[model samples]
Structure formats: structure tokens, C-alpha cells
Target chain A: MANEVESTPNSYPMNGGIGCHSYVKNSHIQRALLHAAKDVITEAIVEKVDITNPWFNSSRTLRVADFGCSVGPNTFVVVQNIIEALELLYRSKRHNPEIPEFHVFFNDHVHNDFNTLFRSLPFSHRYFAAGVPGSFHDRLFPKSTLHIIHSSYALHWLSQVPTQLADRNSPAWNKGRIHGLGASSKEVREAFSAQFSKDLQAFLNARALELVGGGLMLLLVSGLPNEFHSSQTNSAIVLDLLGSCLIDMAKMGIISEDNVDSFNLSIYRTCPGELEAFIEKNGHFKIEKMEELINPVRWDPPDFQMLASHLRATFEGALEEHFGNEIMDELFERFTNKIGENSHIIYDQQYIKETEIFVSLKHRVTDYEV
Target chain B: MANEVESTPNSYPMNGGIGCHSYVKNSHIQRALLHAAKDVITEAIVEKVDITNPWFNSSRTLRVADFGCSVGPNTFVVVQNIIEALELLYRSKRHNPEIPEFHVFFNDHVHNDFNTLFRSLPFSHRYFAAGVPGSFHDRLFPKSTLHIIHSSYALHWLSQVPTQLADRNSPAWNKGRIHGLGASSKEVREAFSAQFSKDLQAFLNARALELVGGGLMLLLVSGLPNEFHSSQTNSAIVLDLLGSCLIDMAKMGIISEDNVDSFNLSIYRTCPGELEAFIEKNGHFKIEKMEELINPVRWDPPDFQMLASHLRATFEGALEEHFGNEIMDELFERFTNKIGENSHIIYDQQYIKETEIFVSLKHRVTDYEV
Candidate 1:
């Protein structure tokens, strides 16, 4: 049995992130995207699998996988989406169940705590006949066996530390190489792009082996605007808030300047065209559909005040593992203070940022057609 | 080369009847539906036709046909929609110089006035195309030659005469049909349904052959509520108004009560499911997508009043052929008087009628697997 959580690297933080889970749990847009993806997947499966013909039909099973699945509660939402998609495919009369035995892989990072995954196992096992776990980034399954690959909010995370940002000598890694506030230094932009390119390639290579000809891959990742100008008021507002908070923490000497400079944010932004080019270069898949939209994630500050105590208590679950209880409390106090200071901002700035969902179909050179 | 329209049918009283061009001249809903239909047609063409491959490449002479095209300036909108659809499709692609050849067939009943269509044709020989005058209820084109089939505001017209109402021999046709309204008899309902079914079948069969496999069909038709009751205050309002006018005419002995009972409107009413089932039973296609909506006709009493003089002038061309201008002017005076008395009521009632647009792809099975 493979470890499911470790295989899906990008979603490692989701199991423990309180706000992230709830955000994804009730996301109707994400649900619709997944539904559409599932439709494409079922179509691909029915086309490639010969089970539709009675001559090829036998008592067999089929495998479906949702990589980078998180635990807590929303694992079942993914399950619900998948089931609904399957039902639609069946209603379309495009699927044949009798064939090879079904197998499903749920993969994540090695560091991910499986306790949450273990708790949600029953709901998943009941729905999917079989579930296996492993890191998909690393070899987890045999080649050319996957019928469908679905991943959301996972590809943005890099496997190793991002090299462009990690290498201090790199132009992109060095700060202040380009003009002032609002605009990113050209070097920093390049660093982010290089890191994204490397990670996306790794993602494509891994899935290329896993998926058979005519398989489908659906990905929803963070995206940047086509003509993003840093000087825009909306752009500076959130960055200024984050910058102010970091400055406050540095003044208190809670974090060093070195550590601050080492951390790289904004590593996940991609445009639809960029992703399309990447896939096209990889050569074997075709873009079926793409949708890009900005979904703002603003929380109610007035309500936040009411839940201050409960939120403080829950903050322990996040930081207590690395630091002692006292340090965790102090960090929460600072975080809460920052939240109170930024309470004047009308909408909650914290959201999925910019997002894009890409649905692709694996193109194969058939012996007869080619 | 095809004639734009043929002469009017003898059965229809052309006396002051409004032509389609009058309805379409500056309609908002019509434009919106046309734009949407254009988008679907372009996308379907892209998916079905392998434009990149030399063998499958189409000509700059694209053969586009608009069936059930009514005569007058209004047919121009459908032509405009097709032209705009093809143009946008061309621009969206990396400029393919081998543009599709354009040949448009604007088909309608033999009774349609070609003079109006000819007057409406734009003076552009390069792209703007000719009109084909004929009944779509019969064969209109060579097999598999059309790339697009577009129709609007025309499907409701039935092929033959409505089953006659008030069959004096049987009381079955004379029983009370409009339950609450002490007026309508069962004969009217039976007559309407029998006429509608016959017309709908003929309409479907005609379009079925006209649409090539893998070609697209965009249809816009006036629809009534699935559960409309004739006795309802709203439904009866129109009938009551017409009834009063007929009664006045009868008192004057201009038209006989026998003619009133024999008269049946050609308009066909359909619900979503009925339309869907009709397409399904026809077995030539499946619904790619369909939507039912109520679009306001945007007829203000004030606008109608302003256009009344021009309408009367236009009526000269149509009415002079039947009832001489003297009788036509007398009829118009009575209608104008009634409109003035119930201007607000007439405006509010007529525009609120529900309509539907069906965007369906008649899938032709390819050698490729599902």
C-alpha cells in the first residue's frame, strides 16, 4: 500500500491550515471546475478503454485518482465531486464498468501527517473501491496505467527549495536589482519564473509516465493578470499590508533580516498562456479549456474580533509543534495585532489570489491515423 | 442564384399584416441571441473541421444557410449574424488566407415577398451573399453542402392548415375547453395541438436533411409556458381583445361568424421538454446545449404611436394587393383607435410573451471511438 498524503506534495499545508480547508470546502467555482474536468476524464476513459464493446467486456475493475488530497473534512467534497462526475458520465452512457480491476492513488508529501488522512480513509474507501498512497512526484505507480489525473492547488509548491530564490548569487535571488515599490525587481521576477518552470516540468514529467494515451489532466493553479502593473492600487494595498506586518515583526527582533530575505513569496503565479506553452513544449497533450478569474478572500474583521479567543487557541495547533507554547502565544498575539491594525481595509485581501483552471487531453498518435 | 422570396400564400390575409423585417429592424433580444448563436456555430465548426489539414481544408466560399428566413429587412440580421460569426471565427485564428468561400441560402415560404429581401441586401459583392427562396418544408439544398444552418422566429409556422374547429357533426369539438372562461370550446385546443404536431414534425424533418452531419443548428422560436392555461387572466386578455374586435366586425357583417370560428393562428407554442423530445425522436441529433428564457419585446406604446404613420405607409405595399387602400385605411383607423384606448395594456401584454433559443449540435458519428 502506497502512502496517499506523501505523494501529493503541493497540498501538504492544507491538512493543518484552518482557513484554507474551509475556503476550499465550500468553493462552488472549484466544484464546477472539477465537475467539468471529471466530464472530460470520463469521456477520455470511455474512448480509450475497449470495455464499451461486449467482446472486450469482462468482470474487471477501474482505477481513478485524485492526487494531493488533504484530510480534515473537505476530502469528502472532492469525493462528492468525483462521484457526481462519474454519475454524469454514466448518464451520458459513455462508461463501461466491466474491464480491468480499478485502482486509485492519493499522493502527497512525505512530511504530511497521515493522522488526518487516516481519519478520512473510511469515507474515501467506501466511495472508491481501492485507495493507495504515495508521493506522485516520486515514482508511485507503474507506467501508462492512469486513466485520469486531477490536481487542484497542488502544482504551485516546488519539490525541493526553489533554486532561483535559494541561490543568493542569482540575479533573480538578489533584492533591489530593479526599481522600487509596487514593481518587482526584474531579477526577482525572473527567479520566480525559473522556479515555476522547473517545478511545472517536474509535474508534467511525472504525470506523463502515469497517464496512458488519451488520459486527461485537470489543473487549477494560481495565476497572474495578463498585463499586471505593480503600481495599481489593488496590487500595492495587500503588499503594503504584508510588508508592514513583516517590518513590525523585525522591529520586535522576533525574526532576523536574513531569514526575511531568504523567504520567497509570489513563487506560484502563472498565466494561462505560459502554462499552455509549457504543456505544448512537453508535447503529447492538447488544451481543452481554460478559465481565469480573481476570487477575493476577505474575512470579516468585526467577526474576527469575536472569535479572537478561539482563534488564539487554534493558533497553537499551527505553531506549537515547532516552538513552545509561550512562543506560539506570543506569535499569535503579534498576528492578531497585525490583523487589528489592518482591520480598516474593507475586503479581506487574503484569497486564492488569482486562479486559473486548465483542462487538457492527452493526444496520441494512433497507428491507423498517423 | 436564388430568388429572395415568392408570392404570398392565398390562405393568408395579407391585409395590413406585419412582416418579419418590421419585428427585427432594431430588436435587442434578437441581436443578443444572434451573437450567442454565432459563437456556438464558430466553436462547433472549429471542433468539427480540421482546418489545418490540407485534405479537410474548407474554401473561402463557405456555404452558410438560414432556413425559415422571413422576408423583409429582418432577414438581414440573420445574414449579419452569419457574416459576423464567420468573420470573428476568421480573426480569432492565426490569419488563414485560404478563407472559406461564402454562399448563403436565405430560404422561406413561396408567399414571402422577394422585393423586400432584394432591397435589404447590402451592396457588397465580395462577401455579402445571395438569398435562396423556397419552402424549407421541402428539399432546399444538395446533401452535405451546408456548413451552418441558422433559423429564427420561424419554426412556429405549421406546414398545413390547422384541423378545423367547430365540427358541427360532433359535439366533441364544441365542448367547453377554457374551463373558467365561459368562451373557448374544446375544439380550439384539439385544433391547435393537431396543427402544432404536424407543423413541428415537418419543421424538424426539413431541417434534419438541410443540416450536414457535424454541422451546427441554431434555432430561436417563440415559446409559451409549459403549463399555460387559456382561462388564466393573462392568457385570456389577448383572446378577449381579439374577440371584441371580431364581434364588432360581425355586427357590421364585414366578416361572418363562420369565418371567425374557422380562423386559426399559425403560431405554435412549445415547452422545453416537448422540444427536447422532438429532437430526440427525430434521432438525427443530441442537444449540445439549450436554454429557455423570457425576453421582453421592448415595444412601448409611445414608440408604436410614433411609428404608426410609417406603418400605415408600409401597409400600402402589402394591403393594396388584397383589400384596396380605402378599406385598409378604414381598418387601420379602428386599430389605431383601439391602440390609443389600451396603449399601456397592449404594450405590457404583448412584450411579456416567453421565448426560447435552442443551441444544439447534430452530432455525426465519426470513425473515432466515443
Candidate 2:
């Protein structure tokens, strides 16, 4: 039974130190990121006119889904904040009283730590909390049932590794490096961006079918600002440093070059323009607000072990899936040392940290199909 | 898909209005009932002063489970009340920053409409809401993981109807009537009592393994009081009236008489002495509080249809399973007429309305086994 707990598909959860990425999710960062967009998200929710008739009571339930709502601490904060805002909107007489019944659906991959997520729920909320286990990239809800959708730091994840990146013979195979590490590979970059566009379209189309007309959605994801390149970004630095450490391991025959080629982080950071174009193409969601915000990483002298854990927690699932669990401790130790060396060298430099995009959308009455 | 929803066994759910007994559960009654025992439950919770030693972190999560937590509205109220009390207890101590988190597991039969139960969960509460689908007759949780358990109107339901009632050749076989309906049959009554004792022992043993030392459990269920005979109880009246109606149907060729004999309700209402004997025999739980409650059903003229629906909702699952769905409407309609006629004949007379037993037990370090 204990073995049942330890041995699950590691494609989504972080390994070691509680065996979950939730430990390193940085709830403070998540809280700060969501709290910043509270007003905008609230505004979208308030503007949602009751397009659903009271006769259609099923849809009348204020259905909200949080895509990629991993195990909590931050999931609660984000959900609570949204619900509170929606409640305030209702109390202000700006929303339908008939829609007071809120049903919140927390969605993630089937392999996500739903047990932990379900076990840590704040059960006294104003609405219903149901765990919908499925990928958000595909439709996880009934048609016209969802009223609002919110996601954070989750959409950057593609539905899968780009097909081109996985093709060993293709120029986009991402040889000897995972995403953003070998930043100059145009084929690799294009494959990630193309996959993101495709996935975002599918995501939008699915939500469009599920969300009633005039429903709302807020998406906060890692992005690349138009002014800055990936090579200069702290996220890319982390990846590059990780890649360098892996290269060092490969030299010692600890990691095979083929394993590196087989592994590519299924994340694609995009600019506001790219997302705007996709939304326009989809035509179901009318973007209310879209902006890029910069979060400067300011840990003086750096905590490499913490950084390694954060990295391990965030991406170890994929790495372990590609490279096997036997190498986890050794890989992370090397990663910690590399980050330690890099942080010391770059400590005085004002590096471009994370760029995040906040997109507020309202589902419009449209004849749209995927 | 809609057929999937409706075609599910409606025997348990009250005849399809909500397809659940939750419609008739009357949250107000539940609230009032639980509120009556607030101080006792509060005292039990507050007395739990281990205050979470860092040495023992696993058990620190104050585990509470509600066995047979049917669909919500009442489930939320009960769970929320308990949590609020626990919070107050913690707050009174000037708050141990480690205010042991509450992880509540809601257990019910697997066929119980868990979707509805989970969907209406009060997610904003202090405790976690997890749906553990299993029969509470057996162990439904990990050993020593639960701190408290609350089960309402659930224990009267035996694991199954007594086997003897269904054995045609056996003298104990109930001929043309359900359990307790043929009041003259001593053999049938003893069989049910035996089954109840056996199931209750199994129930205690299972809960004993799950609950930690010093843990508490509260059970509210339909039972026979010391002064009242089982046959004269209101529940008996409902069952007797239904049985009489079924006999009427059998004569009219609406239902088979054989089906009536085969159909035994899985309920066995016990008196305080019976329960005490069982507890004394299996000394895992020390009875802290035990008493029978009388709810005088004073309807100037009884609403027969309301009574029919109430009965329909409560026993529909097992009834439908024993009989068939074809006779459901005709049977209930006939049941309504009989109850109305019976109520008129008996309304002026002293009628035993409802006898419910409330038992609060404290788990003691006992060297006892079932």
C-alpha cells in the first residue's frame, strides 16, 4: 500500500522531499501573481451578464474551473480570491442572485496528486468543490456549463512534447539539450511556439464550448516580453545551467546523450502578440486585458539547493520519465552545484527574471468550432 | 448520457425529484439535532489536547469522518459546525500556530450518488473534504488515522437483510411479508436482531481499528426506546402500512406475493439495552452518552403522500432491488392511500411517531476484540 503511494507516473509531480512539486511551487509567488490580477479578473466576472436563463438552471450554477489546480496552499488562495471577488460582485447587485450557487471544478492531469489536493481542500467555501481529473488541453467539462476559468503558471505547459522535438531524425530533435537551453536552435524554438499556438487554440475552443456566453477566464502564465530574449531571462539561465550540469554528467557516462535528446521540457513561453493572434483566430474569447509583467528574481547570494529543489519539483516528473528515477539524486546534486557556481558568477548582474502574461477573457456569443 | 443518470438504481434515492434522499433530509432538522449536542461534541473536541507534537506529525492531522454523508446541504452544515467548534477550541488557547489541520473523509456506499455529494461540498471550510466510497459496515479508512466519526441515521441499516428471511425452506423464512412486518413471527424478529448485533459488532470492530485511542464517535439512528415496543414505533407504522399496501397489491396482481416474502428491509431498530449489551460485549468504545429521542410527529392530519415519499426515498433502493421498478408508482400510490386511511383511523389515538437513539462513545484503550 505504501508502495502504491510512491510508484505513480512521475510525468507531472516533483520527486523527493514530500514526493510532490507542491513543496516548491512557491505559494507566495503564486499568491502575489494572482492577487495582482484580482481586480481585472473580478471586473470580468462582474461584467458577466446572466446570459443563462433561470429556466436553464444547470448552467445557471456559477460554474468555475481552475485549470491545472495542483495540490494546494496556492490553489486555495487563488480559488478563494476569485470566489471572494465573485461574491463581492454578487453582493454589489452587479451580478445575478440566481447564480449564487457556485460550483468550482479543480482540474489537472489524471496523474496529478488529486488525493493530496482533495485531502487539503478548504471545505467551508461558498461553492461546491469537485476534482475533475483530466488534461485541461482537452475538454474536461460539459458544453455551456462553465461560467469562469482561471489558470496560473500552467498554460506554458504544452499538451505533450512537440512532435518535432521528439523526432530523433528531425532538425528540431533538440539534440543534447532540452527547451530554451540551446536557445539558438531556430527549429526547436519554432516547434515549441507552434505547439503552444496549437494547444492554446484547442484550450480556447474547449473552454468556448464549455463556457456560457459572456463567461469569464483569467490566464496567468510564464511569457517572454517583446523586449527581452530567452537567453537573457533568468528562467533560461536556470535551464542552461541545468543543461551544462547534465553535459558534465554525460562526459562522465552518468547520462547518455540520447536521453537528453529524448527529453524536452513541454513548456513554451510566448509573447502577448502571439497569444493575441491565437485568441483573434479562435474568435470565441474577446480579450479584455493582455499585458506582460516582469518579476525580478532577487535572492541575494542565491540558495542553490532551494533552486535545485524548485527546478526538480517543477520539471523532475518529465526528466524522470525520460531519464529514469535512478539518476534523480545525482542529477539534482549536480544541478545544485552548477546553479551555485552560476549564481555566484551572476549575482552582481541585473539579469532579466521571469516575464508573465495576464490575459483576461470574456466568452462571446459566437459560432466557433475547433 | 442522460439515461445513465436516470437509469442508476433509484432504490436508494427518493423517487427521482432529486434522485436522492437529500431532498427530504431536511437540513433544518439535522442542524437542530446536531446543534442540540454542540456542547458535548465541542467538549470532546477541546479535550483533545495533544496539540500536535512535532515528533508525531502524521496523526496531527485531526481526522474526522462522516459515515453515510449523503448529498450535501446537511453534510456541509454538520461538517462546518464541527470545524467551527474545533476552530473555537484552538482559538481559545490563543492559537497553537500548529492548529492541527482537519481532514474529513466522507464515506458512503459506492453506489451512493458521490458525484452529488462531492459537488455540493462546502469547499471554503477549515477542513478538507474527501469522498471515500465504501460501505461503513467495514473498515473505510486507514488504521489509527481517524480521530472522530459521525454517522446519522445510518447504523440501523444492517450490512444486508438477514439470510434466514430469504431461505424459503427454513422456518425462519418471512412468508408474504418483510422483516418485522409479520409481528407474530418470533423467528423473523430474532433473526433481524441477531443480524443487527452481528453487523453492529463488525461496525464497532472496524471503527475501533480506524479510530485512535481517546477518539470519539457520535451516532444518531432510528431505534426502539426502552418503553416502546418495536412494532408500535412510527417506523414500524410506516413499514406495516407499506406491507399491508403490498399485500393489497399482491392480491390485485400488481405485485407477486413471493416478491413480498423475498423482500426484507435491511433495517433493525434496537433498544438501549440491546446496544448496551453489544457495547459491553465488545468494550472498545466506552459509552459517554446514550439516550433515546422521541420526535412526536404531530401532523393534525398526516400528509400521506409526504410520508410515502419519505418512505420511498429511504427504502426505495433496497425495495426496488427486491421488487421491480414497474410497480414503484402503483405501490407508492397504494401505500399513500393506506397510510392516509390508517392515519385517519389512528390520528386521535396515541401514535408512536419516531424513536431515535443518540449515542456518544469515547474510544478507550481496551483489551477487547470482536
Candidate 3:
């Protein structure tokens, strides 16, 4: 069953429940990203959103969706921020006493723990909440229905791993490595880059059809600086270390060498230039604001256990499917020990630079009818 | 946590996951109710739905909601039926080449197992599906947003148990019983009846606000006949037998007597007259169709174990909360034995008369704005 589910391109769900290894417990990094982007999101909504839009006037409801919204606390916090900003816009800016009803959709993969999400919903939320389960690369909502779309720290997940990465005959075959970044071959990096472009195009196209004209889409993405090599990022270093650990396991006969060779992480961090090129090519949405965000929560002394747990929470589903569940404990333990050994790398300012990009896009007014 | 959740009223979620005692595995009776209502639902949509209504043409999307949708194969079945009927209406009757997109919201209490519902969704379903977790007695959608609302075998679950049944000094104190029907005191029955009326009113009032003018609301309810005594129904007799088993356990010191006295089921079966009266008083909806449905599935020679399992699945959550989990296996064992001992009651044709009510209501076109 796990293999069958994994064969499907978009089935990598985060660890469910609130256990120690669950995403709910280990999502501090994503939460910090949300905190960094909150002000930017609020500012964009207040400045760029058209309060006099006819759709809002007619429907008397504002529909918002958070794509790739995993189990909450962070999703809930971001949604609350959006609602508060909109309410302020209605009351303070427009001076409209009648605020439209807020209907928010929290979306993720079919295997996401929506039971946990629903159970942990804020008791006194101002908006009606609904959980939408589907790949966001496909259309999840009806045409011209959503007024706001927000995705935070989730766009990095490509729809699937690049097929070339696993084909032995292909130049892009990422043998003995599980990721395309860091010390991966140039061909492998290009393959991942191409896949990211395709996935982003699909995501943008789908959102274009779903969003109303003048709708705002706010995205907080883990990204790379345009001038810096992908290998220089903190995440790339982490993935490289993880891949080395897997290779070590294979050498020790804990896992098969062939399994290690075939396994590839379906994640891609886009640079600002790549995002701009795609949005321009799509032509349906105009970039309203694009800027690098500074994360407020800095780890002065890195917590290696927490970092290891975080990675485990995010990648356990995919890893378990690739190498089987028996190797999980040992694999993560080795990765943690390796992290401790290489702890000095974290102090290398040049190699450990992390980039978070915040982009606000508006659906262009179009004559196309639903 | 169990006590606090139960105390909030509306937190009785069906046993989650696909275990043998889960609602998903034991929902055959509810599935039968849906099958019996399918034809009536399709016919109502064909005859009464206004295809050329401004709402459908303007939005180019039909929003339908199923209130009290449990984790299901049944909810999926019913939603498919509704969508198929709408497609037929658009294609065959109206001769319209353009059929609106379908967006369905499946709703239950906050505690419903939405994860299971989402994972088991029909893979090739035509509609965009969402799970709305909240009580139907409250407003779940924006005003005038829904074009169709359907609930099957779910309206019987009241928002909460009647408080009067637990008050020792009150005339309605239901001592040594778990339900209001079948030899329960007259005061207890009246209290249940009043609670049902209040809950039904809330359901109707909320739907009236959410549904668009000229929208359709279809309901398939487990009910009693107008002139028949509640104590005579098969379910009432079954409840009586189950209550006897609980009292026997209490006598043997297996459970506290006070716990049994305070444990009244929140379910209420409304007769056709009661439904009509509530609709008449509410006045926002016009009854288009009202009739009793004949269930097609019949248990030949009565499978006592299957019957016991079904009852256990439905009531285990409540029972476990009132009395701890340690007694579950023994409680069900005794209940099954008691059912086997009183198997003669199943053959009493008059007492075994089960009533399934099918109701179709049309939202009255009003000048009220959203």
C-alpha cells in the first residue's frame, strides 16, 4: 500500500498527529517563516487589494485558500493574520461597516492529517473553515472563486521527482545521491530546475483559473539568491549530509545500494529570477511585490536534535517508501550524529546562508468568462 | 479530554478509521437508507430544480453541501447521485451545452474523521470536494451560497442530549435507561421530543439562510410513523433490550448505576407530522416531497452479531465517554447475548415496522440580500 501510494507523484504528506516526530511538533522553522512573512502579507493586502471589487459586493463573502496547508498552528496563525488584515481594510480603509463573511479553505494532499487539522481548529475563528484534499498543482477550486491564495514554505515541494534522476542511462542520473543540489552533477541540477519550472507553471496556471480578477496570491518560499550557487544554501548542505548518511547505510548493508541510487528527493528551491521568468511567461498574474524576507527567529546555538527531527517529520513519508520502514530509526540516528560531527559547518557564514523569498502576485483583470 | 469534548455538546464523532468497529465498516444500514432515497432525490432535482436560475448562470458553479456527512462510502454515493442528476437536468431537460462546475462540501461535527473521508474519496469524482467540520445547527456557509443541501440518516443525531434526562430532581429524569423510547418515562419521552423539535428548527433555520432562493434541500431521515407508538419500533425495542443489559451490568457492579442513569442517547427519530410542523413554523422552506421509504436490505433470520456490531459502532464513542473504555468488550458481549435471548421480538411484524422518511424542500424565493 505504501509503495502504491508513493508511486503516485503527489502523495508525500507530512508526519501526522502531534507525536514527537509529527510535523505539528517539529514545524518551528516553517512557523518562523510565517512570522517573517506576516507583515509583508498584511501590507500587500492593505495596499494592493481593491476593496470596491464587484465580486465581493455581490457575493458578500471573501474566499481565501492556503495551498499546501499541512496540519495547523502555523496555517491557523497565517489565516488569522489574513482575516485581521482584511477586516481592517474593510473597516479602517474603506470605512465600510458591513464586512464580507470570510470562508477559508485549508488545502493539502489526500493523505494529510485533516482529522488533526479539524480537531485543532481555533474555537472562535472569524471565518468558516474547510479542508480541501488534492494536489494543488491541479485545480482544487472552481473558476473565479477565490479572492486570496496563500502558500508558505510549501512551494519547494515539486509535484514529483525528476524521472531522469533515477534512469541509469540518463546523463541526469543522480547515483548515490538523494538530492539535486549541493555536490550533485550539473545535469542532475538542471533536471531538477526544469522540473521546478514545469511544476511552478502548472501551479500558477491552476491558481490563475481559480482566483478572481484582482485576487491576491501571497507566497513565502524557501529560495536561493540569484547570484549564489544552490550548493551554498543551508538546506542544500543539510540534504547533502542526509544523502551521505544514506550512502553510508548502503555501504554498511543496512539498506540496498540500488535503493539508495534510485531514491531522489522531490524538492526544489527557486531563485527570484526563476519565479519572475515563470510569472512573466504565464501573463495571467502581475507580480505586485517580490522581496527577500529576514527570518526573526535565529538559532544562536543550533539544536541538532530539533533540526534532525524537523527533517524526519518532513521527509519520513518519502524516505519510508523508498528504503522501507525498518531503516528509518538507524538512518535518522546516523544523520543526527553526522550533523553533530559537522556542527562547525553551521558557523561558515558563506555556506550557511538561507534565503526566504516573499512574493505577492495579483490576478490580472481578464475578459475570459468562467 | 473525552469528558470535556463530550460536555461541549455536538462532539460525538463516529468511531474513526476502518477498524471492524468503525462507522465506515458498519454503515450498511445508513447506506441502505441512501439507496432508498436515491430515486426520490434524482426525481426532485429533475422536476423541481431551476436550471436557468441567475445563480447558476452567473456563478457557473453549483455549490452543494451534505450536512452530517460521516466518513463514508455512502456520502460519496449520495453526492455522485446528486451530481449525476444535475448533469442530466442540464443536458437532457434544459438542452444546455454548458453544465456548471460542481463544488461539494461534506460536513459533520468538528470531531468527524475527515482524514478517512478525504482519503477514501472517489478517485474519478467530477466535483471539487471539501470537508466542512462543524455542527449543521450553526451556519456553515456564506448566505445564499449553496444551491443544494442533502442529509441522510444524520438529522436524528441531536446537537446534544436533553439536560432534563440527567437532572435527578426533574420530572424527565431517565433513571436506569440510556434512551427516551421504549418504556422510558413519559416525561423523558417528552423531553426528547422537545429537544428534537428545537434541534430540527435550528437545522432548518441555518440551511434556510445558507441556501440560495430556489435551492433544494433533500433529507432522508430515520423516523417513526405518525400514529404508531415509539415503543413499538424495532429500534426502540432494540434500545430497550440494550438498556436492560446496561441495568443488569449495573446490578452486578460492572458499572455504576448513576452513570447508566445519566447516559441518555442524543438521537431522536422525528415522525412526518413533526417534520411538517417544524417546517410550517420555520416558513422559509416549502415541502416539495414527503414520503416514507422502504428499505431494500433485509436481515433474514436476523444476524445478531452484525446487529450488535452496528449498534456498537454507532454508540461506542458516547458509551466509552460515560463509562470508561475497560467495560466496552464486556458491555457489547452482554448486549449481544441479551439480543440473542430476546430474538423473538425481531419476528413480531407490528413491532418491527421501521420507517424511513424522505423529505425534499425548496428554499422559498425571498427578497433578502446576502
Model number with the top lDDT: 3
A190, model 3: CA deviation in Å? 0.9
Candidate 2 lDDT, tens digit per residue, B1-370? 0112112232153222245334435334444556565665566567643334221233335767888776555667667767776677657765444456666767655455554554454434555455654456655554555667888767877777778877898777887666663256888888888988887888899898777666778887667666466666556666877888888888888778887877777778887888888988888888887876644443333666666666776677677776778778888788888887777544545555445677888777753221
Ten consecutive residues with minimal summed lDDT in candidate 3 chain A? A1-10
Q: Report, for all candidates in order, the number of backbone clashes.
A: 35, 14, 0
Candidate 3 lDDT over B252-360, as tens digits, reads 9988788888888889888899888988898989999999998877444488988898899888988888888998999899988888888888647777667889999
State each model's CA lDDT, in order. 0.48, 0.66, 0.84
Estimate the Cα RMSD of every predicted model relative to the unseen true structure.
25.4, 21.9, 2.7
Model 3 compared with the native: what TM-score?
A: 0.96
Q: Comparing to the true complex, what docking class would candidate 3 get?
A: medium
Model 2 interface CAPRI class? incorrect
Predictions ranked by TM-score, top down? 3, 2, 1
Task: Please state the error at residue B231 of candidate 2 in Å.
Answer: 20
- Write candidate 1's Cα lDDT for A1-370 as tens digits: 1233233322234324234323223333344444444444455444444334331232132335666664324344555455455445444554543223333445544333333343234422323222223344544444554556777756655553345655677665634211122345676655556766866776677777656555566666655555554333332444444444445555688755554455433334566777777777777666766666333322333443433343343223333332335544455556556556755552444432344544545544352111
Which number leads on DockQ? 3
lDDT of 1: 0.48
- TM-scores, all candidates, are 0.42, 0.52, 0.96
Give interface RMSD, every candidate, in order.
32.3, 16.8, 5.9
